[model samples]
Structure formats: structure tokens, C-alpha cells
Target: MTAVVALLRAVNVGSRTVRSAELKAVATSLGHTEVVTYVNSGNLVLVPADGASPDDVAAGLSAAFESQYGFAVPVVARTAAEWELVVRALPFRAEAESDRSHLVVYCWDGVPDVASIRTFDASVYGNETVIWHGRETYAYYPDGIGRSKLTLPVLSKAAGRVGTARNWRTVLALQKLAQERS
Candidate 1:
């Protein structure tokens, strides 16, 4: 029973609302045990039934969520071990320690196109830093995300894949939860 960290994209934002309780119910219905959700933004930690792979759990959760809520919610999942590596590989560790809210980690369904990320013109964003490692992208907004020009759409376009962003603090919290469950 390996623990998996599942992140649902764009939920509880705008009209695409997903209640935390309903989210937990959906996960429970899928046969995952020890289900835990952190906050209302779709951060979940659980043990998959029948030793399902992280990818399989992600797909099942996405499908179940869509069926239950009548809206598609893309999910990106990682094993507890993989999530630990994500924490260790964070590029803006110093910035995260200082201002966690300004440093976010974006998790994609799969590794984005490396060449596209490498050629992105980040200078236009002004002091923002973006680094790709494994299936995650670490971004630091020195001027705060709301004031920065490096929006999610811009980064997604550059990376060639859409992803969900979580602040450094949430990232660490989710890691801890998944680790405990594992």
C-alpha cells in the first residue's frame, strides 16, 4: 500500500468548485485508504488499493472526480518516494525558506519538453526564476506572483504542458503527509 500524492489542477478556483469533503469521498470510493486532503485546493495523500501505480491512481482519481463533479479535473500524482525527491530537488531552496509564498512548484502529468523550457525567454518576466527538474518546475516570483508577469499560462506555454502550482509550504506539507502515510 504505497502512498500517492495527487494534485488536481484548477479546482476550487472560479466556478470550478470542488468541496474538500466531496473530494475525500471520491477518493474513498475509489478504494484508496488513509485518505487525507490538505486545504481546499485539491492536495490529496492516500494509499492506493491493490497496489496501484501512482499513474494509475492519478488516472482513476481524475476520472472519478470528473464523473462525480460533472467537470474534468486533471490530476498529477507521484509516489511518496518521488515526492521526497521533488522536495530535495527544489531549485529555490533559499528563497523558499525565506518567502515560501513566492516560491511555487508546478507538477505536470509528465515531464514537459525540456528543449522548450530551455529556450524560454524568462527575462521578460523581470527577476522571476524558472527551473525545470524531473516532472516539476520550480518558479520564484521576487515581486510576488500577483505582481509578476510570469503567469501560469505563460509558463505552461513555454513548458509545452499545463500544470498545477503549489506554494513551497504546501509542497512540504503534502510531502510530510504522504511520507507519514507511506
Candidate 2:
């Protein structure tokens, strides 16, 4: 069984509320073992049954979550090893060390085209920095995410795909949890 971190998009925000207990129940119902949820923002760590791939686990979890919640909740899963690389490959290490809350890592369902991501006009967002690496996009919000124009919708449009963003602190916490479970 491979430990995986499943991230649900846009949950506990607006009207799309998903309780942590329900989220863990969904994972457990999917045949995942050692199911655990961190925080209330839909961060799930589990070991998939039959050694399922991360993509397969993500698809199953998304479907199960929607079936249980009566709403579509997109999910992105990464194996513990991949998550370690995500932490290691973070572009803004100094900035992250200084203000982990301001650094965000956006994980996509699949690897987005780098050329397409480049088409995004970062100039419009002022000092915000976005860097795409593999299936993850690292963004540093110098003015903090709430006050910045580089919102998730804009980044999703630019990348031509949907994804979920976690602050640097959450990212590291998820990594640690997955590693422990693995």
C-alpha cells in the first residue's frame, strides 16, 4: 500500500463545507487504510488498498466525496515520495522560511503545459511570483494571498486546469503525515 495525500479543492469555503470526519469516512469507504484528515480544509492522508496509483486514488476519492456530499469536490493526490520532492523543490525557500503563510503550492490534477502557464500575464498581479514545476505550481504572495489579484481562478484559467492550493505550512504538514503513514 502506498501512502497518498489527497487534497480537495475549494472545500470549507463559501457553501462547499466538508467536515473532516466525513472526509475520513469517504476515504475509509474507498478501501483506503489508515485514513487520516488534517485540519478542516480537506487534507486527507491514507494508504490506498491494493497499492493503487495516486491518480486512481484521486479519481476514486473525488467520486466518493461527491457522492457523499452532493457536490463535486475535485481531488489531487500525490504519493509520499512525490510530496517529498514537492517540499524539496520549493522555489522560494528564503521567502518560505520568512513567511510560510505567504507561500502557496498549487497541485494540479495532471502536469500542465509549461508553455501555456507562461502565457499568464504575471505583470498584472504586481509582486506575486508563480513558478511551475512538474505537477505543482509554487506561488509567493508578497502582499499576502487575500490582497493579491493572482487568485486561484486566474491561475487555473492560465494553466487550463483545476487545482488546489495549500499554504507552505500545510504542504509540509501533509508531507510529514504522509511520510509517517508510509
Candidate 3:
């Protein structure tokens, strides 16, 4: 069995609301064990059933979620090892420890278009930085995310693909949860 983390996009946001309980139930029904949800924003850590790839788990959860909830939910899946890689690749570890809510890691379903990341001007934003590492993007907003120009929509457009982000605290919590399961 492989531990997987599923980061769902656009859940419990705006007009789309999904309960954590329902999400856990869906995972259980799909044969994923040791299922655990971090928050209402659709962060789940579980062990995938035998022989299921991360893509398969992502697609299955997405389809099942939409079929049950009447709305499309894009799921980004990563294996436990991959998640550990992302966690270790965090560029702003100090900021994550100081102001966790301001530090976010955005994980893409696949390699994002490099154009946006490559062409970005870090100098344009004061006290903010966006770094692209592997399939994940690390963003730190020292002035707080609400006041920063690098909002979720902007990052989403820059990546040119659907992805999900979790705050530093949530990321650490998920890692701990997955560790317990493993």
C-alpha cells in the first residue's frame, strides 16, 4: 500500500461547499484506508488500495466527488514520498516557522507551464517571493496573503493548470498524519 495525499481544488469555497465527513466517506468507499482529513478545504491523507497509481486515485476521487456533490472538484494527488520531497524543498523554512499562515505550497497535478514562473519578476512584489521547485511552487507573503498581489487566482493563472495549496501548518499536520498511518 502507498500513502497518498489528495489536495482538492475549489472545495468549501464560494458557492461550492463540501463537508469533511462526506469526503472521508468517499475515500473509504473507494477502498482507501487510514483516511484522514485535515480541514474543510479538502486535504486528505490515506493509503491507496493495492496497485492504484496516484493519478488513478486522484481521478477516482474527483469523479466520485463530482458525481455525488453535483459539482466538479479537481484533485491533485501525490504519494507519501513525493509529499516528503515537496516538504523538504520548501525554500522559506524560516518564514514557515514564523508565520505559517503566510507560507503556502502549491502542488500541481503535473509540471506547470514554465513561462509564467520563468518570466515572473520577484522584484515587482515587495517582501514576497514565488519559487518554482519541481512540481510544486512555494510562495511566501510576509505582509500577509490578504494584502499581497499574489492571490490564489493569480497563481492559478500563472501555473496555467489546476492546483491546490496548503498553508505550512496544514502541510506539517498532513505529514504527521500520514506518518502515523505509515
Task: State the number of backbone clashes in model 3.
Answer: 0
Off by over 4 Å in 1: none
State the weakest 10-residue window (summed lDDT) of model 3: 120-129
Model 3 regions more than 4 Å off: 122-126
User: Tens digit of lDDT per residue, candidate 3, span 103-170?
Assistant: 98988888878887788775576678889887888988888877777776777777887888888888
Ranking by TM-score: 2, 1, 3
Question: Scored by CA lDDT, what does every candidate get?
Answer: 0.89, 0.89, 0.86
RMSD of each: 1.1, 1.0, 1.5
TM-score of each: 0.96, 0.96, 0.93
lDDT per residue as tens, model 1, 1-182: 67999999989989999888888899999999999999999999999989999889989999998888888899999999999999999877688778888998989888889888878877788998888887888988888888888888888888788688898889999999998998
Superposition TM-score, candidate 1 onto the true structure: 0.96
